[model samples]
Target: MRKSFQKIAKKYALLKQGWSPQQNLFYGFLTYIIIGCILLCLPVSQKISAPILDHLFIATSAVSTTGLVTISIFDTYNGFGQFIIMILIQLGGIGYLTFTTFMLLSTTRKMTLWHKKILSTEFTLPNTIKIKDFLKSVILFTLIMEAIGSILFFIAFKNEGMPTLEAVWSSIFHSVSTFCTAGFSLFNNSFMDYVDNNFINFIISMLAICGSLGFIVITDFGLMIKNKSHELSFTSKIVIYGFLILLTFGTAFFYFLEPSIVNLNDSRFLASFFQCMSAMTTVGFNSVNFGVFSQAMMLVCIFLMYIGASPSGTAGGIKITTLTAVFAIMKSRLRGRSNITFLGRRIPYERLYIATSSFIFYSSIIAIGTFLITLTHNFKFEDILFEVASALGTVGISTGITGDLTTFGKLVIIILMFIGRLGVLTFGLAIWSKTITENERKVLKEDIAV
Candidate 1:
């Protein structure tokens, strides 16, 4: 029996070694989703299951951190099922690679080169050659942020008349979810009831902001504070500045243009601020019905979702850094300059290419997903577009019609969520590997009339 077990293990190990890094990461994510789906399909979850498609939808939503749901979370799933969903959200947000690395760290007490490579890709780090420290930092930072967030939320809930145990659990779940930008909510209508509740909105907004800022920026900030001479990384600086600027503009635009929001009798400032933060961070918790939003406000929300939080963060969308790079590149070209500069630093051509490619890939995926869903569902173009953006951005705001989507529409959304979370470009590249020829022949230049 021992010899057979060893033989099987060796065979699996050999097979795994032959797989590429991208393949391994893709398989790992798929395996996690399959396990989550199976668990969710159990009798415990079936009690709340409206349909098999609904269960799969919720499972995919949680695992992809997309937050799109066919039913109210509070009414649909039991405590056991909700717990499972929360676990999936945490795992999905931190990433399968991060989870595997954590497991290896616990069991073998060491990280191998393979682990570092996976971590690097997951975090979008410069190199995985020396990633043990970064991995530790990522774990520690997440725990600390979630812990503090939970405490704040618990205090707020407790004051609102929630019992001790329930309040604690709610706080813990929401803190983790918000910080991961997973957008799972215990409430049926998200934070709709708390639109004017400054305290709750502020707490959630802060958590969302922290989560979407990315671990790289957090680490850089920490190092800068510790050593006065050590400046923050250029990438971190750009992300911070860009995030603040966008948030400011988004908040102001919504406050002035949206009558539904601006007409609120009390705490209108808080409502506007929270919504702006939510949209910018791709943390889809809404304090009000998004369907009631004016066309101008809806467009603003779409734009904010399109230019989402930083890379290596829990949030999705085209990513703020990418948008910033595109603008910089365009400005430089318009000015007849060869170099794209931001913050007194020249952006590398390679990085610009990456940013451009990411934008193109992200836009293409959203367009395709939107087209497919429209074919199956008899919904308005605006509604379908909203849903597609929500899935692609991993933003949960909806027009209150997600639950009515057909099976085909649901599947289309599930695919969009998965691709968005994994990153459209990364997933595409993983499936289609590119090769360079060793021998290159120079091509003659041909002139054409302009």
Candidate 2:
């Protein structure tokens, strides 16, 4: 009896210690969705009857910050439902751990070392910033930015003859949604009608761009622009440069590509510019129709969406740093350089492996998701590819097929969105963390024919 009790106690201890960072994140997101779904399914949250599956779908999309939806938001949900979604977006945008950490600190003034590890990973903090400081900065940045965005949007909406109270609600809702990079629009066509409105276009684009810049970059803003001479981190440099390049090229290419499908006489450069920002940032606001875009234009959007946004932001995708690292690695190999170098400095081998591994894992899923989705529907290959790319990137710009997908197709997309939001490798690690055993085995490498 004593031996059996000891064995049981040992097993319980091992299980207790088995929870990994990845597992916590995965479970955290799942818990968020479950709660969101239940709340959304309540009678007070909906304007009309909604199926349970739809509720789950919307809840997942909201928490993931992906704008993909099976139904219309304004038509199907009442104000309360919209409010709930915005709350979920806020929770998801800055992240669950961030909010919880702040609350814990406020109420208890303490967090365990284990919590610090999770918060550090969640916010992508470096050793320079403590977890408490990072969480406070994140909250302060979000609130300030959201406030400024709301004021701008309010002015724009009021000028358009929106009622005073309605304008206030719209401004606040959109400000939070856009800045969070959660593209749940109250409008039907998603800023399609406001394509020519410079103020709306300018403000929303800026808000999304800021949100996609990531918390680390935001936290380093002081160092980046200080008149007192401060050094910016390497990660910030890569994100800023990469983000600018994508915006420039995406806008120019989109503008030039317009003549391929439609006459370029009245080309909407502003619309093109907005789409570029929205796609690269993984904020799915569209000032134009997806159906109107030619295959080439769709391809451009797909590429940008696949690249997604910077690390640790509300946006999701392969990430700017990952792609930047992958390209740098490629250039180095082509030049026969001894080390992977970008700009003037050499990147560590560990970073290179991480970038490569991230690329491989994300790319592998593209194929798997595409195949699984195509099997469930008869959609064209290109459309399916675009859908998969958008889903995996967490950019909700659909080719207009989201509403028609079968149950299996929706399941595939839900899985993609979940993984895309948490990221590919992290989700895989979360699953792998189920079993904890240290292995230091070595295996011989062999070359095989390509």
Q: Highest lDDT, which number? A: 2
Q: Lowest-scoring 10 consecutive residues by lDDT in candidate 1?
A: 125-134
Each model's RMSD to truth, in Å?
2.4, 4.4
RMSD of 2: 4.4
Model 1 Cα displacement at 63 (Å)? 1.6
lDDT of 1 by residue, 310-357 (tens): 888889888888998999998988989988997678988988998999
93 in model 1: Cα distance from truth in Å? 1.1
Backbone clashes in model 2, listed as residue pairs: none
Q: How close to the true structure is residue 356 of candidate 2, measured as C-alpha lDDT?
A: 94
lDDT of 2 by residue, 339-425 (tens): 999998888898788789989999999999999988889988889998889888988888789889988888888888888888888
Instruction: Compute the lDDT of residue 177 as modeled in candidate 2.
Output: 90
Candidate 1, TM-score vs. the true structure?
0.93
